[model samples]
Structures are given as C-alpha cells and as structure tokens.
Target: MALIRFVLQSVVEILVLPVTILSYIGIWDPLYKRFFPYLMVKITSAINDKLGKIKKELFDKLPDFASSSGLSILEVGCGSGANFQYYPWGCKVICTDPNPNFERFLKKSIAQNEHVKIARFIVASGEDLSQVASGSVDAVVCTLVLCTVQDIDMVVKEALRVLRPGGAFFFIEHVVADKTTWLHFFQHVIQPAWRYFGDGCCVTRDTWKNLEKANFSELNLKHIIAPFKWSLISCHIIGYGIK
Candidate 1:
C-alpha cells in the first residue's frame, strides 16, 4: 500500500511541476487565486467540523473588548474567512491575505455571520503588514498560516507589531510530527512536492518554536492529532499568545 501511494504521489508531482513553476514565477497568480479559495472551502469545512469544539475553546480565551464600537480583530491569512463562525459576538474583523481572490468568498462568509462586522480586506502578506498600523488592533488571529509563510518569524513579529499592548495572537497550526515517528519521516520526504502543490505549505515546520521566540508576554500552547484517517498533516498546535 505504501509503495502504491508513493508511486501515485510521484506521478502527481510530475504532472503538477510545470504549473508549480508558473505559480512560483507569478504567471499563474490569477488562476491560482480563483481556484485556491474554492479548494480551501471544501478542505476547511471538514476540518472546522472536526475541530469546532477545540476552536471554540481557543477563541474563548480572547478577552472581551469593552468598547461601544466592539472588539477589533485582525486575522492574518484570512482565507475565505473560515474562522468567522467562532469569533466573538459583534467583533469587527480586519482580514488580510496575499491573494485578492479570497475577498469575495470572505465577504460571502461575513454575510452569513450577521453578528460579525467587516472592517476591511487588505491585500497584504502576513510577513509584511505595513498597511496595518502598529498597536492598532485588539487581537490578531492566524489559522493554518505559519507553515505556509516565507518567513514565520517575520510574520509573528508583524502580528506583534500590529497588536495593542496586552493584545493576543491566536493560532491553530499543523506542525512537524515527533522526530522518531513515521509521520515525521513522511512529512520530510513528501515536503518538496507538498509545498509546491499545497500553496507553499511546509508540513515539517517547527511553528511552536517561532511562537515561543516571538516574546509574547503570556503564551499558552498545546498539541493534538486531529481525527483524520490516513492524513499527512494531523499533528497540530492550538492556543494563544498575549503581547
């Protein structure tokens, strides 16, 4: 079975290489943008269903912002606004992503969640959020983002930079499996092809280490293996860090 899987993966990689090269060269951006949100919706819906309780608990840790205008949250890599359902009631969301293709999907999502407010959608990368001002938002949220960024540290720093004092950075990310495990071995072996096909996602990233080094005033994080049968990316870290 393993041999057959390897052969299939190799064949798919061969077929995908040309498009991957185009994607890297920026020539495929428009098509990729159009397709990625549709793909993510199908993928994340299953994930969100499985992780709903866990996500609710994580989002529960976010402190209530007692202002008449309501809480302000800046979500990095807010693809399709998948996490909008779990947000605090009446909170205002500022969405950011490198892909402009997701804005329509995000707006559609916001329309469904009537309690949530849309601040704006910024076409920006998490690693360089210069468009967002420093110490402006009450909190920053990231879901399944750290692994795909070009520089995880820079993204973490940028999140920190935009957060108000005592604000939180909430994250739920899949990280590298334990070094001695078969899953760990599989992650590294399949990473090159996976990164290209999966929109720069690296399964073997030490995302926890990056969060720890970000110097959040308070950090609470833990790992879990989601109930995914025969999945490469199951091990995940979910928690929040306070600035």
Candidate 2:
C-alpha cells in the first residue's frame, strides 16, 4: 500500500511540474484572468466579507500617525481593487497589481464607490514600487498576497521602504498549518501540484518569520483558525507592525 501511494504521489508531482514552472513565470495569470476573472472576484469578495470585522479591528489599532483622511495608502497586489470599499474615507489610495489585465476589474469596481473615485492605479509589482515615494506612505496594506509573490523578501523590503517612520504594515494572509502533523504531511505532499494550479500560492509559508526578519520594531500578531476546522490549510494570521 505504501509503495503504491508513493508511486501515485510521485506521478502527480511529476505531471504538475511543468504547470508549476509556467505559473511561476506568469504564463497562467492572463489565462486565468481572461477566463475566470468573475469567479475570482466572487471568491475574493466572499473571503473579504468573512474577514471584514477583523480588518476593521486591525485598522482601529493603527497609530494616530496613520490617517484615514488625506493619508497616502498603498496596497500591493490589489487584485480587482476589491479592497477599495473597505478603505477609510478621505484617504488617498494607490492600488497596484503586476497584472495589467486586472485594470478593467479595478475600474469597474472603483466606479461604484465615490470615496475611491480618486484612487490611483499602478501597474507594478510589489518588489518594484518605484513610482511610490519612499517614506511618504502612512500605511501599507496587503491581504492574501504574500504567498503569491516570487520574491517575498523583496516585497517586504519595499513595504518597509515606502512606509513613513512609525508607519504600519497591515496584512492578513493564510499561512501553513502550525499544528496537525497530518495536515503538514498533506501540505508537503500536495504543494507541488497546488502550485501548478493555484497561482504559485504556497499553503505553508512562515509569513510571520518573514515579518520578524523585516525588522518591524513593534509587532502585533493574531492567529485565527477557520471556524470548525483545525486544519492548517484554513488557518490565517492577521497582524501589523510599525516601522
């Protein structure tokens, strides 16, 4: 039984290797955007609703220096501009995504919101946000994005650079399971295949460790497991830090 299982797993991994490689190179991004953008938007909106209260709570914790009015805010990987509705009023919002195809969705979404009418769109990656001034932004927000970036460290560095002194970096991301040995086993076993079809998202990344290494002076951590599931796959950590 063990031998058969091992053989099947190896075959699945091998079959998925090419797709994984292509995803890393961004081949599937356009295809997915073109064919499945509506589905993607629905899923993202649902998840955002599920996490809305938590987002509001985190926002309330921001330092006084972080302004909801006339303050500059940059959101990396701002897919379809799903976050615009959640942004506080009177803020200057800049939404960026490496995929230019997301612009249409962003425009449509922003059109419905008077508060976000002034929101600017940038075609850039998290690793290279040169258009944004260093130390000018009061807050940097990223949600469900770290797992998909190719260079996580570079993105973190960029976040730190753009944020003003005492600024906050807020993120809510699904991370690898910290408990459940069996789930960890499954994550390892299926990661290669998952990467192939899921836009290079890793189910198990030490995201908090990355934040710590980024050297934020004050770190606030919150771990929330999905309701009714102890499985690591559904667990998420939401927190922020000050520079």
Candidate 3:
C-alpha cells in the first residue's frame, strides 16, 4: 500500500508541477494576482493562525511610536494585505504593489481588518519607491516578495531609503539551498522554467546573503524548512534587521 501510494503521489506531482509553472507565468499574472487574495486565504487557511504569530513576531520588533497613530508600516508587495490582520489595532499601514489589480483585493482585506488602518496604496515597484520619501516610515515589511523583484539590490536600497534611523526591515522569503547538495542542483536546473511560471520568482536566489549586503546597522536572519509539499521551495528565512 505504501509503495502504491508513493507512486501515485509522485505521478500527480509530476503532472501538476509543469502545468502550474506554465499557467502561472505565461497565461495571466495580473488577473491571477487578483485571484491570489482569495487563493491565499484558502491555501493558508489551516496555517493562518501560525502565520499570524510569525508576522506579529516581526511587527513587535519595531520600535513603538510616540505618535498617536502608531508606526507607519510600508509593506512592499503587500499582495491583498495578507498580513493586515496580524498588525496591532490602529497601526498605520501603507500597502504597495506594482500590480494595480490587487487594489480590489486590498479593499476586501481592509474591510475585514478595520482596526488596522490602510493609510495608502501606492502603485509602485520595490526597486522604485519614488512615491515614498526617504527616511519617512517607521518600519518596512516584506514577505514572500523578494524572489520576484527585478533588482534585489535596488529593492533593498529602496526599503532602506524609506526607513527612519533605528527602524527595522522585516522579511520572510524562501532562499536558495546550500551549494553542496543535489537539491541545490535541482533548484538550478528548474529555475528558468520556475521563474517563468512563478512570475520571475527565482527558486535559487540567496536572498539572505543579499539582505546582509544592504548595510543594515544590525542584521540577523536564519532559515527554516517549510512543509513537505513545498520541499523544492522549503528553505525559508524569517527575521528582521534594524537600520
């Protein structure tokens, strides 16, 4: 029974992986980005509570504000505000994404999490945060977004540019596996197709290393394995750095 089940599962994964890659990137990402809000709610429904805890951990690291409204959090690639419910009540949020299609999804999330205010929705890329002023925001939050940005260095610089002194950059992203292994080779082999299908997400990017180069005053991060089903994308890093 075990052998049969393993065979069946392997076949299913083989079929689903290819099609998922092609459709995700080539078919329609803008339209799919809109659907991602609902898809994510369903996909992460079982783990939402756990994810909330992780997000809260990062948010808590930010310095408490002296102002009435609390800290201004700039969420780069805020994709439908998936982390909105995790924020403290009354904290100000500035959600930004290059794709305008996600605006409708953001509205729904904002309505659901009314306590945390959605102060602004900027249609901007992570590399070019021209709409946001330098050293303005109290904290910057980015999750699962570093993989797909056009320029990781520019994006990190943009995040740093908007952060006030002593503020933190909270990030949670899947990174490249270790160099001395077959998994690392696998990641490199499928990366081109994966990048196309995953909307420019390079499964092999060493995002943690790039974060270190961003010149944060206090840098700290570590890796954690994801659930088994995402084995290929299982190497994840969740941590924050004070600027």
Candidate 4:
C-alpha cells in the first residue's frame, strides 16, 4: 500500500513539477497561471462540497458592526477567490496573494458571486501585508494557506495586525496527522517531494499547535477528516480566532 501511494504521488508531482518550475522562472506565465487556477478551482470545489457545514458555521461568526457600512475582509493567499461565495452578502473583501497570476481567476469568481464586493486584489504574500493599514479590516481569512507560507508565525501576526479589535481570523487548513498514526509516517516520508512539487505545501505541519500560541484573544478550533477517501491531505483543521 505504501509503495502504491508513493508511485501515485510521484506521477502526479511529475506532471506538475515542470509547470511549477516554469512559473517561478517567469516563462509562459499566462498559460501556467490559467492552468494552475483551473486545477485549484476543481480541487477546492470538491473540498467545499464536503466542508459546507463547517464553513457556514465559521463564516457566520463574522461580526457585523452597526457603525460600519459593511464588513471589510482581508483574505491572505486568496487563490482563485474560492472563499468568495462564502462571505456575507454585500461585504467588501480585499484579496492578497504572492502569485499575481490568480488575479484574473479572482475577477471571474467575483463576477459569479456578485453579492460579495471585491475591494481590491493585491499581489502580496501573507507574511508582508504592509500595503494594508493596521486595524483596517473587520476579518482576515486564510484557507489551505498556512501549509505553504514561508513563515507561519509572521503570517498569523500580520493577520492580527490588519484586523480591528474584536475582529476574527478565519482559517481552514490540512495539517499533520496524529503522531501515532500510519498516515503520520506517510506524511513524513513524502514531505520533501511534496513541498518541491506542490507549491511549498508541507504535509506534516503542526498548524494547530502554532495557532494555539498565536495570541488570539479567543480561538475556536476543531479537527476533522475531509471527504476524500484515503487521500493524503484529508486530515484538516477548521476554525476561527478572535483578535
């Protein structure tokens, strides 16, 4: 079973490795940018179908201040704007990502989800969001992002910095499996290749532990298995933290 899993993973990664290399080198940006987002949309759509209930539970907690015109949300690593459909109606969202390639796909998502207003789409990573002012947004969101960020602590800090007092930071991430599990062993074995070919995603990150120490005024976190049969990335953590 382990050998079979390794073989399948290698095949998939081999298909994506060239695109990853070319994308970083700035060759065929248009082609790769389009292809990558298309792949992500399909993957996220499947995941969303399973996590609909969990997402509804978390997003419903986004505070609605009577003084403000509408909720302002900043989504870090907002790839293809997958969470746009989950935002409250009429709320304004500021999307930021290091990969500028996602901008076109984001516009398409915004058009489809017309009720959610897109304030702007900036090409910035989660670690350095200096472009956004401190205490500017009512909420900060990151879905499937922490696994790939260069510095998880810095990203969490930046999310807190951008959020207004009492604002929330929402997240959904697949994390390291339980230490005693066979899945944990698999995750460690394949982590290096996964990071190289899967856009810096680390399969065995202790994301929940990091979030616990992130200094959130309040945190409501839960671990769940996503609806992917025997999938390597099925173990997940979904929750929100109040700043």
Instruction: Provide the lowest-lDDT 10-residue window in model 3.
Output: 60-69
Ranking of all predicted structures according to lDDT, beginning with the best and ending with the worst: 1, 4, 3, 2
Per-candidate Cα RMSD to the true structure, in Å, reads 3.2, 3.2, 5.7, 3.8
How does candidate 4 score on lDDT? 0.84
What TM-score do all the candidates reach, one by one?
A: 0.90, 0.85, 0.80, 0.85
Best model per TM-score: 1
Clashes of each: 0, 0, 0, 0
Q: Model 3: clashing residue pairs? A: none
> Across residues 68-155, which tens digit of lDDT does each residue of candidate 1 receive?
4558999999999889999888788889999888888888898899888888999999999999999899889999988889999999
Query: What value of lDDT does candidate 2 attain over all alpha carbons?
Result: 0.77
> Could you tell me which 10 consecutive residues in candidate 4 have the lowest summed lDDT?
61-70
Model 2 over residues 96-186: C-alpha lDDT tens digits? 8887777888888778766754457898989999999999888899988898888888998999999988888889888887545566556
- Candidate 3 residue lDDT tens string, 1-243: 446545654665575676566565776565566665576555445445445666677666654631344678899998777788777777788899987877887898899998887889999999999999998888899888999998989998998899888778888898888988666766766664566456567888899889888889988797887654645777889988778
Better of 1 and 2 by TM-score: 1
Candidate 3 vs. truth: CA RMSD?
Answer: 5.7
- Candidate 2 stretches with Cα past 4 Å from truth are 1-9, 15-29, 67-69, 228-232
TM-score for candidate 1, residues paired by index: 0.90
